[model samples]
Target: MLNRHIKSHSQYKKHMCTFCGKGFNDTFDLKRHTRTHTGVRPYKCEICSKAFTQRCSLEAHLRKIHGAALHFAYKQRRDKLYICEECGYATHSQEVLHLHLQDNHPSSTFLRKASKKMEMTLQKKQGEDQTENSTADEGSR
Candidate 1:
């Protein structure tokens, strides 16, 4: 990752935007940048049914507009999903999505740097389990 960051400082941009001639060191950035020109809003809010170009935008809309709380316990990792922008292929496993990108869309700019993992959000199932356990303990006491 450090090597990739160092390479980003160089004059070379491996991924170039077809729309505006913008250059990016990582293909992931280029893929995200292309969404601006393509107007492809892949991330959709489940509550309001509104769409967004980025996942963070959707999350912010959920928090701000829909009053959704995104609190997570310490050291808890959230459920992750990797969706293909080109084909709408969604997967819970990052490795599966990576393999799909490599095999299906080799020419596309969705391939990110090796060893870089996307930040995950918390899952509701674990919280529910904790609640259930606490209730059981209180009943036993």
Candidate 2:
């Protein structure tokens, strides 16, 4: 089993392909590169009609362009999902969910950030009120 986080770049780490004198980051990437030579298209985009040899690339394109709308139907159908309620898109990972929010739901992202700011403000106000109450008790005694 390969360690997902472990970096093993000695063989194909830097994408050095012996078959066609090309390099890729991963095996799928190498396969995609090989497809360039063989002209094998496995995945096709429904929105833009772009062809890719790997399914991941097609998914990336779909998520990047039609995240909220196009990817909307993807979550329920997918085995694994990262749901983003802000934009209602299901992604493969939380990182992709964040990316979707940034790329597709910018307004919701801003609102979330602004709501956090408001929460901090309220916390600070509560702390100030507690200190004021303590000082008032000290003066009364």
Candidate 3:
């Protein structure tokens, strides 16, 4: 409604894009528009690790890209609270939750260590096999 009204009248454009000379009446509108030229992403999705310049864009990504069932926080305020799926720990910060998952979650931490061990074992076996092959070739010569 505001955009329509602004467009109908030659609105005094206060906000201007740095990259382009395009003018916007609202500062928020100008910032959101400027992201297109700057390729700046300030907001990021915790689930998929996708980034977006605008908060609305990130919210839209959660709905359309992630196919998440949208729920209003008014009705489900407790659900809005970030809780660990692995443990019962709760935190508002996403970075804290990510650290908690990596440090405290048994599956993630253990699996990472186990995977590294397995990779090292495989590499050692390959090195031994190569050495044996080289020794055999030298002996035959």
Clashing pairs in 2: 9-13, 15-23, 15-24
Q: What would the TM-scores of all predictions be?
A: 0.54, 0.34, 0.43
Residue ranges of candidate 2 with Cα displaced over 4 Å? 1-7, 11-19, 22-29, 68-141
Position 32, candidate 2: lDDT: 49
lDDT of each: 0.76, 0.62, 0.66
The CA lDDT at 54 in model 1 is 80
Q: Which digits, one per residue and each the tens of the lDDT, describe model 3 over residues 52-129?
A: 766567778999988987776754443233334333455676455656667777576434643565568779999999
Candidate 1 residue runs with Cα over 4 Å from true position: 1-8, 73-77, 87-89, 93-141
Which lDDT value does model 1 have at 133? Answer: 100
Using TM-score as the yardstick, the better of models 2 and 3 is: 3
Would you list the rank order by TM-score, best first? 1, 3, 2
State candidate 2's TM-score: 0.34
**TM-score of structure candidate 3:** 0.43
With a 3 Å backbone cut-off (N, CA, C), the pairs that clash in candidate 3 are none
**Model 1 lDDT-worst window of ten:** 113-122
Task: Give per-residue CA lDDT, model 2, range 31-125, as digits (tens).
Answer: 44666665666566877778766666777888887783444453355445544444335556645566666677778743475356556877999
Best by TM-score: 1
